[model samples]
Target: MNDVVNLAEKLAQFSEHWSPRVVAELNDYQLKVVKLQNSFVWHKHDDTDELFLVLQGAMSIRLRDGDVSLQAGELYVVPRGVEHQPYAEDECHVLLIEPRGVVNTGDAEDTRLRADNDRWI
Candidate 1:
């Protein structure tokens, strides 16, 4: 059976920053929603590319070459094996798509910021 997912309402259920909530699943990939603020650690995914879509506010992905800023409704794809860090000055809503079991902090582990997988909203 299939069901519709309301992103906004789903987002309303959680408020912790940097912690992503599983909203939906598509095959092997999981669609997760997160609220970002401040800075994230520099890390790289060795196996899979990650898609970051800004649902609201603003965000920037800092790479070795340059930093890419994304506003509401914008999106960016961080290719696999590329080290990058994400930051936001204010509350930013984001939707991330990556294969199931992908760690939130990538190769860099931050016990304070690491979120458990398969947590549904």
Candidate 2:
């Protein structure tokens, strides 16, 4: 547990966009690093809030009412049951913090954008 987990180093281990690689855990939550490009499916975790922290580049979380923009060193939390879709025009590195089993696509029926849970780098 003493080993340091460098976000940039772990982020470099994979190149697949929208797929998150687990890096660390705190209690029942998991810290994941994901590369994002283009747009993602609209989904929501009915049981848990999802956190998105921008490590590099920028992204936007589009809600039905509006949108939330995030740049490097910024973070946003999508409250539980809030319908939202994430999008990026270019390669964006993000740190996601959510419950261990919370699906990336949440309750959305579109399985194509659903990523494998608990995958580690």
Best by TM-score: 2
Model 1 lDDT, full chain set: 0.93
Please give the CA lDDT of all the candidate structures: 0.93, 0.94
- lDDT by residue for model 1 (1-121), tens: 1879989999999889989999988999999999999999999999999999999999999999999999999999999999999999999999999999999889997667888988888
CA deviation > 4 Å runs, candidate 1: none
RMSD of 2: 0.6
lDDT of 1 at 36: 96
> How many steric clashes between backbone atoms does each model show?
0, 0
